[model samples]
Target: MEAAPTPTLLLAPMEGLLDFVLRDVLTRVGGVDRCVCEFIRVTGSLLPDKVFYRFIPELRNGSRTLAGVPVRAQLLGSDPSSMADNAARLAELGAEGIDLNFGCPARTVNRHGGGAAMLREPERIAAVVAAVRRAVPAHLPVSAKMRLGYDDPGSAMQCALAMQDGGACEVVVHARTKADGYRPPAYWERIAPLRQALRVPVVANGEIWNLQDAQRCRALSGGDALMLGRGMVADPGLALAIRAADAGGQGEEAPVEVRWQALAPQLARFWHLVCKDLDPPQRAGRLKQWLNLLRRRHPQAQAAFDQVRVMTDQRAITLWLQQLVAAAATADGQAPADPAA
Candidate 1:
């Protein structure tokens, strides 16, 4: 009897957030196969090795975490020649794979002819991917990440075909237009035609906040895989739950669901890593940012967020988190209420 394969869970690359530190924590949760580093912006000149190392210093460790998960480096730019040149450098630096970022919605990035702005000109996508493809070894995989379109969802199919013509090994559609910008009710079904049109595999992204959402996304996108961002951040155990259900009790790690009450110890570990890399202000901001997302899943996280909303000290926040965990454990006799409610 053959068992179904576990779905590939990818931790998304979110710039200015979810850096290498966060990647380490999430991938350690056991279901994530690999993670993409935040996008490194490439302009006219080739960036130095230090720039790549700064965003993904794990390159020194074979571009992997301590757990041995692979981390692909992602670059954001529109120039064919410069992008190819940088892609060559990344490959030379021992990148297992390279990802092109055409889906970023930052006005600054788009205004400079990068990110989702490139969607307006689908032909140029072919040119850039073709250039990068030619520069790298033909055997090496080059993938793209992008939104459905600039303003309308109508551009998705054409844009996806452009990547195929450009020689991308796979394309990831974020299930929303550049205009959607993290709004609710992602158009997961819109990705179906694009996935059906391409020769390469299509990975769906967006609005997968839980196991139910993940299942719904799979059915709607008809995708080969799923790329998780804020959803994984909110519930680090989501991918594990999905994997456990698929394995049908055959997997090594039993499924674990993370509730806000149970998340304090993990957050403590996450904070420890955050402080090692970021300054005081940055550390405080990072904690708040994660709590803001976790709040959606765990109402208890709201109390934690409120505790540190004004505090600049990570240590203080850690103590408050520990106390909250203790209180929650005591209140419900070990089973906390649903935070979503």
Candidate 2:
């Protein structure tokens, strides 16, 4: 039998979320080929060295992830020169690849002519990619991530073509138009045409919520790679499951109880990391975001999350979380007693 192809699964970089702790957890879960860091915003003339370090701290000692998987530094900006300068700084700091963000749908980002708005002018998109390509080392790859278009699907082909023409190694296309705002029924079929139109590799993104969705996306886009976002949050083991399924390996869906039990420790770790860096109220808010996802997976998670949600005191929250974990263990039949009850 011929050897099976290596699956290409990338972790999407979500701003204000998917921070270092989450990245570390997901990277160790296996099956993710690469992960992109959150976009480092570029607003002015100079690209500071500190900003590069803030986003890609692994550069401090030439580390990638603990698993040795590569992480790319993603940049969001409208200025070609500034983008190029930042890309150069990232290269100097040891980034294996640089990804340009042209798919961000946030109102604030688009209002500034950054993100998907860059697609409005194909010439500018081409210029930015070309400038960044020229500024980075010849061997270091530069890529672009984009949505179908601002309001329609028409500009995707043009924008992708421009990026390819400007020397981008690959372009990842999120199948929804900016107006869609992550609604259901992502138009994966739209990416197939763009794949046909561009010379560079085309990666399909958006609405790939499960292994089935990943399979459908591959069939629809006719592309080899995928970039996952919200899907991973709902189920962190999704990438691994997809790869296993593709390889004809039997994989079990992590039972709801098992998933919650596993996540308790990760949540504890994330809480500690956030408390060390943020104020009480800020830390609580971040914890709440994870709780929201946790609750979706296991309704009983809300009981545990409630113990920490309102407490601004880190010690109080930590204790509450410990009690919650104990309660979850008892509920899972893995321990002796329900401490909360």
Candidate 3:
């Protein structure tokens, strides 16, 4: 019998989060096929090569993550000419693919006529994609990430078809309009219509909190690929679990102690990498953001996060982490307490 193809699962790139360290850690957990870099805003002249390297350091090695997973560079902009120019530069820098961000709902992005706001103008979306396709290398894949619409689901189908006509290889819909903004119960049903409307591959995104959610999303969109976001932060092994369940393998739940023990090193690694480029205070804030998500999986994550948050002094934060690690070791075999609770 011919083997079924391995489903493609992508890790959605989050700005000011999901840096190289986090990507490295999550990719190790398995089942993630591709990773997209945070959107690099292209406003004016073509970005210098260093800018591309800074946002997508993976491009240094032909856009491959540390684990050999391919990473695509994502761009956010309103100008088709500038976007196409930048896409060409990214391709020259060895980027394997280019992803356009039309899904972000941030007011700043929307006000700039970018992100979800672009959905209101299907012609502009098509023009941007067409221009970029013309400029970039033919073999380099160009994809787009979009929300359902600005304020209504009705607009998405037309926008999606426009993106397809404009030459996008695939479109990833976040399953909600701009107004939804990370709320509960994502309308996966809405994505179904958009999928049927477009000839390009559709990858579903949003509110996929577990294996069941993933299955439901696949059924809804008739899509084989999925893009995971915040859910991935709460449970790093979610993709692995989903893959296991799909393969008829039983899922193993890691004990709280094991979860924390595994996370501590990852936290430290992320901190170390950020500190190398960012100042101490900025690095600390980034650490807190990660801990905020880590706390969801292992409640005990707060003890370390709180220590880092309260202490303004960098040296003190480092000392507190050392003590927390020591304390965690001594509390072996006990049910992990929820520090955030």
Candidate 4:
């Protein structure tokens, strides 16, 4: 039998959670093949280039993160004509790719008749996708993401088929109904039939927090591609670890440890960028938000979170992080890169 091809690992486009700032820092850690920017809500307007740039700053840098990973812009809306018009502009702006978001389960998004609400109307899904596909150049890749269904897994295959029929080159199934709402057990098996039937690639996503989950997701979904979300945020080394295990061949591979010593610099760099780019009020919260998630996988992050939990001042947080980075560098026998620098 011919050998199976290597899997393509993508970073999931988490709204508010995984914006360009985190995307830049995480991609810098390496192993991610591509990233999808957070969903740009298209209402009825053509949405100026600034709107696209505001959401996906990478468009200014050749549609790629500073680390050079291509970032695809995602659009969420119910209006097929508006979606098609915006997609055409994104294409003209030189987006690396376009991804339609039909999987967002936020109440605000759903209340607007966008996101997973569209899953309730498969014909609408097909019309929007076909419209966007027609608007973009033939060489540009158009993709779509969706849950198993609005409330159950009943329409999973129908929605997947709709995406394929609408000219999406690839489709990513999050493996749970929107009603499941980021719950445990992502129903990886549900993706198997969709993978088998779809002509385009099917990428499995959801609840893959560790190497074991990645292995099992691939085994059950029977697909090579996977999209990482909170898992990657909680453990920045996840994608690289998954890649290492993949290359190591058929056995239980040891977990790849991402030491605090290594992560200290990334923390420092994230802070630097946050201070540089974001407003004063938003800066401190961003670091704490990341540490809150980081504490899921790293005990050290719990301590770090405790120290900065009440800090609203960016200067105070900067001082605390500098000390943390310096301490880590000392233990690792290296000179620290100043956190403020």
Candidate whose lDDT is highest = 4
lDDT of 4 by residue, 1-341 (tens): 98778789999998778999899989988889999999999999899888899899999899999989999999999999999999999999999989999999999999999999999988999999999999999999999999999997989888999999999999999999999999898999999999999999999999998888998999999987999999999989888888887888443322334676788988999999888878888888889999999998888999899989988887788888888889988988899976444
Error of 3 at 256 (Å): 10
Sliding window of 10 residues with minimal summed lDDT for model 1: 332-341
Q: Each model's C-alpha lDDT?
A: 0.83, 0.80, 0.81, 0.91
> lDDT of model 1 at residue 169?
91
lDDT of 3 by residue, 106-190 (tens): 9998999988889999999999999999999899999999999999989898889988999999999899899998888788888
Which scores higher on lDDT, 1 or 3? 1
Cα misplacement distance, residue 128 of candidate 2 (Å): 0.4
Best-to-worst order by lDDT is 4, 1, 3, 2
Cand. 4 TM to true fold: 0.95
CA deviation > 4 Å runs, candidate 1 = 248-262, 318-341
Q: What is the lDDT of candidate 3?
A: 0.81
Per residue, candidate 1 scores C-alpha lDDT tens digits across 1-341 of: 98666567788998877888878777766688888999999998899999989989888989897668899889899999999999999889888788999899999999999999999999999899999999888777899998999998888888889988998998888998999898998999999988777888899999988877887898988854899899888878878877866666544222434555456656766787777777777888898899888887777778778878899866687676666656757754774322221
